[model samples]
Target: MTFDATFWALIGLILFLALMIYIKIPGKIAEGLDKRSDDIRTELEEARRLREEAQALLAEYQRKQREAEREAEDIISQAQREAKAMATEAKAKLEAYVTRRQKQAEDKIAQAEAQAVQDVRTRSVDVAIQAAEIIIADKVSGKLADELIGKSIKDVAAKLN
Candidate 1:
C-alpha cells in the first residue's frame, strides 16, 4: 500500500520539529528573552534611583528656601525695631529742645517784667521828689529853709536808689 499526500505532509512536519530541536533554537530564544528582561530590570532600577535622588534634591532646596525666608523676616523685624528706637530718640530730643527754649523765653519774660516794675518805681520816686520840692519852695521863704530842703531831698534820693 502507497502513502497518501496527507501522510507525507505529517512526516515533513515531524522532521522540521526535530531539526529545530537539534539546532537548540528554543533554548537560544529563551536565553535572549532572559537577557532582555535583565537589561530592562537594570534600567528600571536605575530609574528608581534617579527618582529618589531628584526627590532628595527637591527637599534640600525647599529647606534652604524656608531658611532664607525666615532670615528675611528676622531682618525686616530688626530693621523695624531699630527704626522705632531711632524715632523715639528723635522725639525725646525734640521735646527736650522745646522745653529748653520755652524755659529761656519764660526767663526773658520774667526779666522784662522785673525791669518794668523797677522803671515804674524809679519814675514814681522822681515825680514825688519834684512835687515835694515845688511845695516846699512855695511855702518856705529863706536861705535856711532852702538849705534844709536840699539836704532832705538828697537823703531821700540816696535811700530810694
Candidate 2:
C-alpha cells in the first residue's frame, strides 16, 4: 500500500524521538541544567558572602572613624582648657609683678622723703651752731669765756648729732 506525506512525517517524528532517547540527550540536558543551576546558586552565595563582608568592613571603618573624631574633639577641648588655665596663670603672674613694682616704687619714694628730711635737719643744726658761735664771740672776749664757749659748742654738737 502507498502511504501519504502524513504517514512519512509520523515515522520521521518517531525515529527522531527514538534516536534522541538512545543517545540519552534529554538526561544529559537535564543534568547540564541542574549543574548550571547549582553553579549559579554557588556563585550567588559567594557574591552574598562578599557583600556581607564588605558591609561589615564598612561598618568597622565607620566605627573607627567615629572614635577618631571623638578623640580629636576631646583633645581639642583639653587643649582649650589648658590654654585658659595658662592664660589665667599668666594674668596672675602679671598682676603680682605689677603690684611688686608698685610697692618697690613706693618704698623708693619713702626713702627719698626720709633722706630729704634728714638733709634739712642737718642743715638747720649747722646754721644754728654757726649763729650761736657768732653771738657768743661777740658777747665774750676773755680766756675763760673762750674755754666756756668751746665747752658749750662741744656739748651742743654732741646733743644735736
Candidate 3:
C-alpha cells in the first residue's frame, strides 16, 4: 500500500482525540463552567436581597417624615390659638381699665363743681349781710334802728329757710 497525505492527517486527528479523552480534559472543563454558573446565580440572589432591604428602609423613613410634618402643624395651630386668646384677654383688660379711669375722672369733676357752687352761695350771703348792715346804719338811729334791724333779720332768716 502507498502512504498518502490525507490518510496520515486522518490518523493524526484520531490520535489527538484519544490523548484528550485519556486525560479527562472535557470533564474538567464542564466542571469549571458549572462552578462559574453557580457563583453568578448566588451573586444575583444577594443583589436582590440587598435591594429589598434598601427599599424597606426608605419606606420607614418616609413614614417618619410624614409624622414629623403633622406634629409641626399641630404645634403651630395650638400656638396660634393661644396667641389669639391672649390678645382678646388683653383687649378686655385694657377696655376695663379705660372705663374705670373715665368714671373716676367724672366723679372728681362733679365734686369740684359742687364745691364751686357752695363757695359762690356763701360769698353771696356774706355780701347781702354787709349791705343790709350798711343800709340800716345810714337810714335809722338809736332804738328805731335796733327795732328795724331785728325785724329785717327775722324776715331774712324765714326766707332763707
Candidate 4:
C-alpha cells in the first residue's frame, strides 16, 4: 500500500497510546516528581537559613568575649590603683605616729630633768639647815640653842613665802 498523510497520522496516534498503556505510567507520577522537587528546594532554603543563624550566634559570642576581656583588664587596673593608694596612706600614718612618739619622749625627758633639779635644791637646803643647827648647839646652852634655832626657822619660812 502507498503511504498517505491520514495513514501516518493514525499510526502516530496509535503508537503514542500504545506506549502510554504498555508502560502503565499514570499522569500523577509527573505531578509527584514536581512536588518532590519543590520539597527538596524548600529543604535547601531551610539549611541556608540555619547556617546564617549559626554565623550570627558565633559573631555575638566573639563580641561578648572581647567585652569580658576588657572588663577584666579594667578591674585589674583599678585594683592596682587602690592598692597603691592604700600603701601611701599607710606610710603617711606610720610617719605621723613616729613623729608623735618622738615629741612625747622629748617632753618626758624635759619634765624628768626639771624634777631632778628641784629635788637637788631641796636636799641642799636641808643639809645647810642641819649644819647650822649643829654649830649652834656646840656654842650655847641647850635651851638657848633650841630657842634661837626655832626663831631662825620661823624667819626663814616667812622670807621664803
Candidate 5:
C-alpha cells in the first residue's frame, strides 16, 4: 500500500498520544488541576473567614456608636439639670438681696423717724422754757424770780436726763 498524507497524519497522532501516556503526562495534568482546585478552595475559605471578621468588626463599631449616643444623652441631661440648679440658686440669691435692701431701707426710715421725734421734743422743751421765763419776769420780784428760776432749771434738767 502507498503511504498517503491522511494515513501518515493518523499515524503521527497515535504516536504523539502514546508518547504522552508513556511519560505520565495525563496523571501530571490531573494532579495540576487538583492542586489548582485545592488552592481555589483555600482562597474561598479565607475569603469566608475575612467576611466573618469584617462582620464582627462592624458589630463592634455599631455597639460603640450606640454607647456614644447614650453617653451624649447623659451629658446633655446632666447639663440641663445643672442649668436648672443654677437658675434656682440665682433666684434665691436675688430674693435674698431684695430682702436685705428692703431691711436696710426700713432701718434708715426708722432712724429718721426717731431723729425727728427727738428734734420735736427738744423744740417743745425750749419753747416751754422760754414761755415760763417770760411769765416769771412779768409776775415775780427779783429775789423770788431768782429762786423760782433756779428750781425750774433743776427740775427740767432732771426730767431731761
Candidate 6:
C-alpha cells in the first residue's frame, strides 16, 4: 500500500470524533442516569429490609421454642399433682371400705353371741323346770312353786346386771 497524508488525516479525525462521543455524547443523549442510580440504591435498601425481616422471623422461632419448653414443664407438673391427688383419694376410699367391713363383721359377731346366749338360756330354763317338777311332785303346791321360780329369776337378773 502507498501512504497518503489525506488518508491519515481522515483517520485521525474519525478517532477524535469517536473519543468525543464516548466521553461526552451519552450524557447529552440520555437524561435518566441519575434516576437509575437512585433506583439501584432503593433496591439495595429493600434488600436490607428483607434481611431484617428474616432475622425477626428467626427471633420469633426462638421465642416459640422457649414457650414450648415452659408449657411442657407446666404440663408435667400438673400431671404429678393429679397423680398425687388420685393416690390420696384412693387411700381414703380404701380406709373407708376397711372401716365399713370391720363394722359389719363386729355386728355379725354380736348377733351370733346374742343368739348363742339365748339358746343356752332356753336349754337351761327347760332343765331347771324339769328338776323343779321332780322336786315338787308330792311336796309343794303349784302356787308355792310358781312363787319360788319368780323369786329365783329376780335374783339372777339382779346379779347379771
Residues 5-91 of candidate 4: C-alpha lDDT, one tens digit per residue: 999999999999888877765566777888899999999999999999999999999999999999999999999999999999999
Clashing pairs in 4: none
Output the worst ten-in-a-row residue range by lDDT, candidate 4: 152-161
List the candidate 6 regions with Cα displacement exceeding 4 Å: 1-25, 28-37, 138-161
Per-model TM-score, in order, reads 0.64, 0.81, 0.64, 0.66, 0.83, 0.66
The C-alpha local distance difference test score for the whole of candidate 1 amounts to 0.93
lDDT of 1 at 42: 97
Each prediction's whole-model lDDT (CA)? 0.93, 0.93, 0.88, 0.87, 0.95, 0.85
* 2 versus 5: better lDDT goes to: 5
lDDT order of candidates, top first: 5, 2, 1, 3, 4, 6
Q: Determine which window of 10 residues in candidate 3 has minimal summed lDDT.
A: 152-161
Quick one: best lDDT, which candidate?
Answer: 5
Model 2: how far residue 72 lies from native, Å: 2.0
Query: Per-prediction count of colliding residue pairs?
Result: 0, 0, 0, 0, 0, 0
Q: What ranges in model 4 sit over 4 Å off?
A: 1-29, 135-161
Expressed as tens digits, the lDDT of each residue in 1-161 for candidate 1 is 89999999999999998998999888989999999999999999999999999999999999999999999999999999999999999999999999999999999999999999989988987888888778888888699678978888888879877
TM-score for candidate 4 = 0.66
Off by over 4 Å in 5: none
Can you list the residue pairs that collide in candidate 5? Answer: none
Point out the worst 10-residue segment of candidate 2 by lDDT. 124-133
lDDT assessment of candidate 4: 0.87
Candidate 3 on 1-161: residue-level lDDT in tens? Answer: 98899999999998988888889888888888888988999999999999999899999999999999999999999999999999999999999999999999999999999889878876776788778878988988899988987888787767765
Residue-level lDDT tens digits of model 2 in 1-161: 99999999999999999999999999999999999999999999999999999999999999999999999999999999999999999999999999999999999999999999989878987787788778887898789678977898788779866
